[model samples]
Target: MAALSKSLLDAKKDKLPAQAAEGAHVHSSGAAQVEGDELWDKLPRTPADILRHAIKGAIRAFTLAYGARVTLAFLLRLLAVLRKKDTILGALLAAVRSQDGPRFGAFFGLFAFGWKLVSHSLREIRGIDDRWNDFVGGCVGGLAILAETPERRVSYMQQMSVRALQAIYASLHSRNLVSIPHGGAWLFALTGSQVMYAYMMRPETLPSDFYRFMVGAARVPDPILRYNCTNVRQGQVDPSIAVDLVRRYKGTADNLARAQGMSATPGVIPCAVIHPTSDSCAETNLSRWLRVFQMIAPVYASLNIVPMLTLRLKHFLTAPRTLASKAIFNTVRSSSFLASYVTIFQLCVCLHRNLHGWVERVFGRRMADSRALVFLFGFLNSAAILIEHPSRRVELGLYVLPKAVDSLFRIMVQRRLAVVIPHAEVAMFAAAMGAIMSFYQREPECMTPMMRKLMRPFFGRY
Candidate 1:
């Protein structure tokens, strides 16, 4: 019995240190876990992170556009199917036999490549810390559109140019040049660029043999202004473009008229009229208008998210208190802001028209022909801001004033005043924004949550 008790005591003493060590190990693991979580919470989210997340969201949303494009391309081929020329494997073989088949494949291929290029490049161009993904995007934007024919190639470049412009616009916001809501300034940079490219960008000439293969062999229809609407089915020139081309390229209307089996008499003989496919004036006009609307469709799609998100956020925040009143107020206010941007754009368009008109009347030439008129466009665009609603005008002022101040401040700080301002660049953005908002948003009710905190010192008790 005494021997058994001694053994039991020794066993209990050995167990004590093991249990203590196990408890200490558990406590240390718990502390380490808490420290890791704290470090994660404190880490500053970079602009790259925001962009990365936004892009991922955009990819999820991109299926709609990609599917639509593929569907349209497929549908356009159905006419060939109905003619009973070839079916399925036969059609595939036929396409493989010709250059047009490859051309069709190339357009979509470059388009996809261009899309990828622009997406990645945009993020890279944002700053010095650009990642490989963004570098690929920009390079893709620049080089992807290159193809066999100049006309098709230029058309592709136009799409890329618009995308580049959009990237620049979005980059401006990302750089804090503009305060577009919910960080949405970055979302549609790609889509809007695509739209603008489709509408306004055109290559002046056809690729001749290459175009012929795409249209005749491939049965792909030529876009409306391909060859400037020249090359009638009878192999004659079109009147619309012919009249201008004759004066510029072929010498004169009378010269072209006499050369093209018509009387040389200027007043009597009509200019070249090459009608293709019996397509009437109405049909041509309708086709052109449809393409124009297609360009606008993406613009609408890209921007539609903004108002939706703004109104939703407004509703969510103003919930459970005077919801009806806020709803009515936000409906008018939010929508007007959206419309104000459109209005500003429309006003610039009008300015563009008027400037062109004045240039034509005074200078006897197109506004596009003059470099001065082009420069004036930037100035006119600046003036268009004040033309918005009063509240919108105020918001614009608040937005611009800070950036303008920061511009001057940075210059001063970078020079002799560097020592006076220990860290001007670091604090300049928020301090400037707060100062401008203080003066503009005197009414505390109008302030956002962040703005409220910022303005607290300036407007005490409010």
Candidate 2:
């Protein structure tokens, strides 16, 4: 019994050192974790060190911005070459000669430099770091927009304002402070009305790309658009305008006679004038939609395909077949949606023309080509938005809202209904930049997924 007791005591003594070593290991690991969790601003840094870091960050930002622009240009030009619109050498030259890349790089780089410097300096001054410092820093940084050409400043300001508003709404929604069912669809419809009106009545007010898109979708000669606008403003239809349309559509004079007889108010534009290409409105709309789908499919496909191939090469390589299939699917889906939009709008206009004739016949009064009718048709046509992907609806709504607002403001100013404030765009841009920066730092989840993704490389994730 004494020998057994001695053996147990010796075993217990050996276990004691093992337990002590395990405890020490755990404590050291815990201390290292705590150290690792320290906030960035809490780190010691001299003023000169901070400036050095800012400059380095700025260069990184510049490289990223410049690279992205060059990449996009190269891809687009390559597409043109593929279509035989340009040669390969021409495409390369176009990519190489992209003047806007340096400007974009400068704006982004300077903004990064200013943002880091100001935010870090404020923390040193106040001996505390908070989101407000980030906001102020962002505002100062946004002044780097001046690095862009004057023509681009207003455009950037408008885009930022829209994005800021969207971010605010997202934040409110996340907190349950705001809730509205089908709110995005409603917003799209409302803003879309203004956009359609501008497209018809004031195409000049729209951005160049938007105006060109409208022209292409309409598939009408410029003279026809001008004539239609004039007639709509006059609130009367002119049979005389049908002569040129009849010729353009390859219809005989007898077609105009048939149109006048079929139309209740001769002044109201006939179906032949609206869709002069085919006798059946339904058939015409179907063919137009199919044609647009075919035309845009390649464009959308390239847009998705190029980015995946170039920007996400690693991910693409890892799952080449799957990624390629998904990109193709998305391209088809987006093309279909855009085709539906254009066709639906045209169909709605044709419906409006018929409705105008019916109303005039019933009431025995001319109300054709009225602004009220135009606006009503525009609102009705926005229902095409229902066919778009649910996730994309809000994004599309936000995109068009700013343009609509710009058009409204322009119309108001033209009619002397509103006074223009000097440098209003500049002030708005600065304020919006501040809000955007604060959201980027303190409430990144409030930003759109695309916006957050674009910013992560520059700002770092929270």
Candidate 3:
């Protein structure tokens, strides 16, 4: 009888369902069976569900930590502004208006003076630091070349192109470029900002606010939670309600970061390796340009406002200081302030000219002859530069401000509006570029085999 009972028990145990299995039967009363079914139903949570919960929790934790820090920062700035009777923004605006005409010229003069001083100092310091001397020397050489006429500009650009090619060659041979991590803190900040923006601006597209709220309220054991949410099909969500949530949340983090004047690709290391092929080079250029635009757009958009704050602060705080110290600080600040503007101006001009020439090739019409087209192209180029210059200032302002204002304004206003507007502008610009390439430029043949070989590693994979 004992052996028979053991055999029956083993058979029953073998028939039992796995813990994660669904619809396991229980030999019990109907109520007990229903209870067992309920327990079993709770056990089969998918990994995707787990991941979703985890991501949601991570988002919350990040927002809390980041939001707190930003709030604290904004609060400090508010306090400073308040101590001045809320006149800071107005004063800054007034200062900008007053200095608009002279600021650029003033910045240039200061830059020239600094360059002279740096050059002299470096020459003197050459004995102690040869590498520094070489770098300064190279910069001086580049500047000298740039000072030449328009005809010489092409030659200078060509020379730079050659140098860039050689640098790529060296980097390829060394294999050092590929091993180095490209993006760092800036990247993290940018990624965080992107995520934040997605979440905040498009909250409806993400999971339900109630869901997030519950997770926050539940005090769940795991730091993260996973939930199985509906997926989109052709931009349509099965339950239209949930679809709206994901879209809303998709880029909320990015919007928040933008409000704070952070770059999505911050801390991206400069690319050193050059692809030997034309296709690879083009790909590399595209990637580099995208990164540059990402970094540049916000700064440019905020330029008009940034200079005002800097100038106002300088005028208000340093008015009592010695003229020499004031002048020194002003000179240093001015040059650094305008560096982005100068760089962007140069880059845009170069790109515009190149695009114009390329357009001329395909259309068989001189770009210069069409005044309207020229003006339109010129305007777009200028707009691009303008948009790329001020992002840093806004970022700096957010960083310096106190937390309370930061959180409130950033969450409610800047993240929702300011960031999205600029991004739209960037998207438009990209679309315009694509249209121009498709319609205006002639399709070229594939690069040579040797060039292909060289480019394969760097550009081909992408």
Candidate 4:
């Protein structure tokens, strides 16, 4: 009995040490976990960190924008060289050469500086922790577009305006007020600029474009000048008008044969000068409306018997889409902005044609361009614009009035001053389509040959 009691005591003593060690192990693990969490909490979320991340995002954005611009310029330059329009290593050599290389460097700087400023502002607005990954990756796109508009094309005043406007847009995107998708950023900028230019800013103080319009060849893209081909001064149409407008008018029925290829120079093509009439208002109004009408004509140009397919595709690959693409989806569903605008435009156009027919029956043919007739036509166009999109006319008004008022003001008041900004954003918007005309001029065969001819002044017909 004594031996058994001693053995039991020894067994119990050994068990206590093992149990205590297990408890100590668990405590050690818990202590280690607590310390790990404390270390994480102590890490800094400093302004320096935020700026570093913001800069990372800015650098990424600038890299993409600059790359795209440089690539485009390189391709264009290469094409020119290949076509024998330029020297063999013209752009390629210029890309490396110190003096010539500065153009691209400046081009790169525009986006880099613009985005860096935008990113720092955005970092504060979003309050996002700086991670290696930039959440707003490449959001500052379209910077290349600004660069594409050659420095020569943009005046200082216009550049200032654009910079201010672009700053607003970038800030909004950074703040997420204007989201990346659905063109919200673009919409905001467009609306804001319109308001600033029309109501807030006195456009009259701005420099004039009419003098340019009157003395220089009518800008080929001038809707009033391009469409009617009348009222625009003869020989004053930019020579590019020959390539653009097809020389619709002739000196007389007998002179049609001699009018072919009037000339390759810009603003030199013969077009009818506006016959001085009190109804110039109607003519101007009608032409402006017609320009917008043509812009939306594309959607109606084709017919699709089964439009529902677009919706099914949208439901499939759910990546981000464009305004036009979203419109396509809505179209397939039987209702969309496109459908609404198309229906309205078509109905109004038909009504105008019917009304014109009635007028022809009542009045003589010579009254076609009469003030009353032209005014009615202009009113119908205005109605179509309202019907298609309620805000469209207001947008157009905002866009044009500022310039019109400014130009008129300049002509009457600041008659001697140069263009306030050689070309304002609104002016650029109007001439956006004409910007493509540069492709023709850039093309070696089209422009380089002519340029060579001009350069070799002494060698005739070379």
User: Which model scores highest in TM-score?
Assistant: 2
Candidate 2 off by > 4 Å = 1-44, 248-265, 306-311, 362-368
TM agreement with the true structure for every prediction: 0.26, 0.84, 0.17, 0.31
lDDT of 2 by residue, 288-328 (tens): 89988877887787778766765577899999999999998
Residue-level lDDT of model 4, residues 1-462, one tens digit each, is: 334434433553454333222212222256654543343233223445534644554454444434434444554465567578887567755544433234444444443333333433443344322211121211242142354444433442243233234334444566668754523223433433332222212323333453332212212233423323332222234434333333342223322332344443222123222211112334433443454334333322211211212222354345435544655543343223323322333333234333644655676434422433332332333332333233333333333343444444455555564445543543453232122111111121222222333212211110
Q: Order the candidates by TM-score, highest first — what do you get?
A: 2, 4, 1, 3
Residues 1-462, model 3: lDDT tens digits: 334434533443355333112222233456656665465444213334333433443333333333333333333344447567666565444444543223322322332333233332442333121224323433442342323343334333433333233334334445555432322223223332332223323334333542363233222111112211111112112233222333334424333333234222211101110111112333434444444444433333333223323333465455535543544454444334334322333343335434644555676453322433322332333222223224333233222122222233444564475342432322332232222111111111111222233222211111
- The local distance difference test score of each candidate is 0.36, 0.73, 0.32, 0.35
Number of colliding residue pairs in model 4? 9
Candidate 3, residue 132: the lDDT equals 42
Clashing pairs in 2: 237-267
Q: How far is candidate 1 from the true structure (C-alpha RMSD, Å)?
A: 19.7
Count of clashing residue pairs in every prediction? 4, 1, 70, 9
> Which is the winner by lDDT between candidate 1 and candidate 4?
1
RMSD of each: 19.7, 11.2, 31.9, 21.1
Off by over 4 Å in 1: 1-74, 92-133, 136-158, 173-462
Worst ten-residue run, lDDT, model 2? 19-28
Please identify model 4 stretches exceeding 4 Å from their true place: 1-51, 63-316, 319-325, 329-380, 390-406, 409-414, 417-462
